[model samples]
Target: MALCSKIIEHDDTGRYLTINQIYTEPFPSAAASGKLRVEDNNGIVWILSYRVKSGGTRVFSGDWPRFVQNYKVKAGNTIVIGMNGTGSTDHKIEVM
Candidate 1:
């Protein structure tokens, strides 16, 4: 399948993009169990987890209990997302 992304029109001053919400498809087909990450322009890292919620995958984390998880991505590279639990990963993003 193809990947999709949306641009948020708002001031990102003194902060980074927020992942206020995340949605994935079904497991074994859509859902993935593991670490979710997002790296911004800074040099920080945010990790999260997700499972199928209703009919899509939803991410959650206690370490980053904000509207969004932020980080500083590696230049020339996208943020990296990896699976770290006893399960499979449907997809992944590099948090850098």
Candidate 2:
């Protein structure tokens, strides 16, 4: 299932992808609280730290910048995060 589909912001390409409260609740258990295994469309697995900041905002940091770099992601691109399968810790990301 798709967790969220968001437009990449300038700051998101810099250090992390910030997800607002509306999108945070659907994340799988592994991604909602700690380190998550995110596999890009290219099948590259990136380890990103997932945390809820004050005010209920969520973020995926750590290697997120690297992922942006590798994909040449930019502002206005649509990024989608979803579960690879039911009850799986693996998540899939696609940039379009």
Candidate 3:
């Protein structure tokens, strides 16, 4: 789906990730208020919930700490989130 965003310092420290508004724009209305299944490149999976705040959406989950720990993602990294298929409920994550 070509959805991608940079990992900011806040993401690493706050244990949460922000989904850019450009990416969220195409999400189904319900998606903005629900959980999404995000899978990393190594097949690790996390269920992240979306929150609408300050006119934008951010995604976070209880497993965020684990994900960060396992992935070793740092600030300034690029994280890409893409749907597995058309209308699929699962999204894949790529770190670069």
Candidate 4:
């Protein structure tokens, strides 16, 4: 599955990346709250924890700061999240 969303202010300072509702809808129930591996454009993998919150689903973890810094992500940037076939571990992300 492939998903895309724009970076927001909170994402840059809160140490959490929000997942859009459209993308979250197709996720398995268990994915609502658990660890997930997200790879960046450079193929660096980050294990982030996700959960459904009042606002939406957010991906976060201790490595969030490093992930953002490494990618030089900023508010207004667009990010694409790609997952290989269902149940696949090859999840990747790209910034544009």
In terms of TM-score, the best-performing candidate is: 2
User: Local distance difference test, per candidate?
Assistant: 0.36, 0.80, 0.63, 0.62
Query: Which regions of candidate 1 are displaced past 4 Å?
Result: 1-30, 66-96
lDDT of 3 by residue, 1-96 (tens): 755556657545356776645534544542555766777766767766655556565555566667767777778777777776633246776777
Model 1 global lDDT (CA atoms, 0 to 1): 0.36
Error of 3 at 87 (Å): 14
> Which residue segments of model 2 deviate by more than 4 Å?
31-33, 86-89
Looking at model 1, report the run of 10 residues with the lowest lDDT sum: 5-14
**Candidate 4 lDDT tens digits, 41-88:** 555677766666666655555566777788677787776666744332
Question: On a 0 to 1 TM-score scale, where does candidate 2 land against the true structure?
Answer: 0.84
Highest lDDT model number? 2
**Each candidate structure's count of clashing pairs:** 15, 0, 0, 0
C-alpha TM-scores of all predictions = 0.34, 0.84, 0.72, 0.69
TM-score, prediction 4 = 0.69
Screening candidate 2 with a backbone cut-off below 3 angstroms (N, C-alpha, C), the clashing residue pairs are none
Which residue pairs in model 3 clash with each other?
A: none
Candidate 2, 1-96: lDDT as tens digits: 777889988888898899888733666575445888878766678888888777778888888889888989999999998887633346888898
lDDT computed for candidate 4:
0.62
